[model samples]
Target: MILEAAMLHVKEGMEGEFEAAFRKASHIISSMKGYIDHECHKCIEAEGKYLLLVKWETLEDHTVGFRQSQKYQEWKRLLHHFYDPFPTVEHFKKVAKG
Candidate 1:
């Protein structure tokens, strides 16, 4: 599995709206090819900060399959505007698990 992680820093005062938009956007991603699951986590110490984690069967499942699809345009339309500096997404492969 490939783990995609992004540290989303939402625009100030738009946190609520961002979360709501994300809720709607989730469906778009969940329906994509190779999608396994995802999670959005709010930060405790910082406001307007979120951690987005998505599991995919392979790297291309996200970088190409999803990002290249029309659904990605909808995903971007729904949630891209909420970011400040724009999050950087990275992928990882499991090394060790408890």
Candidate 2:
């Protein structure tokens, strides 16, 4: 599996609405082809910061499959507005596991 990670920063005072919209957006991603699992965590020390980890069956599954699909438009609409400067997303393959 490949992992996609991003540090999300929700707009100030919109964390609640962002979370709600994210919950709705989550379904859109999970239904995509090659999607394995995902997690969204809020940072304790940072009010508007969050960590997003998503597992996909392969890199193309995300980079091409999902991103190219119309579902991505809905995903963008659901969550993109919350970001200020926008988050950087990176993909990684497993190297070592304990």
Candidate 3:
């Protein structure tokens, strides 16, 4: 499995807006091929920040399949503006688990 992580820094006072946008955007991603699951968590220590964790079968499923799909365009349109500084996404493979 591939894990994608992003630390989203939403604009001040736009947490609700960001969540609403993410709700819509997530649907687009979830409908795509190779999508496993995802979770979004609001940061209690840092207001307006969120952590997005997504699981995929492979990195290509995200970097190529999902991002190149038409839904990604809509996802970007809906959610891109909410970020003050764009988040960096990272991919990881499970090293160990209990």
> Of the candidates shown, which would achieve the greatest lDDT relative to the real structure?
1
Rank the candidate models, highest TM-score first.
Answer: 1, 2, 3
TM-score of each: 0.99, 0.98, 0.97
Query: Which clashing pairs does model 3 show?
Result: none
Model 1 over residues 1-98: C-alpha lDDT tens digits?
A: 99999999999999999999999999999999999999999999999999999999999999999999999999999999999999999999999999
Per-residue lDDT of model 2, residues 1-98, tens digit only? 99999999998999999999999999999999999999999999999999999999999999999999999999999999999879999999999999
Candidate 2, run of 10 with poorest lDDT: 76-85
Query: What clash count does candidate 2 reach?
Result: 0
Q: Deviation in angstroms for 29 in model 3?
A: 0.8
Stretches of candidate 3 off by over 4 Å are: none
Error of 2 at 16 (Å): 0.2
The lDDT values for all models are 0.97, 0.97, 0.93
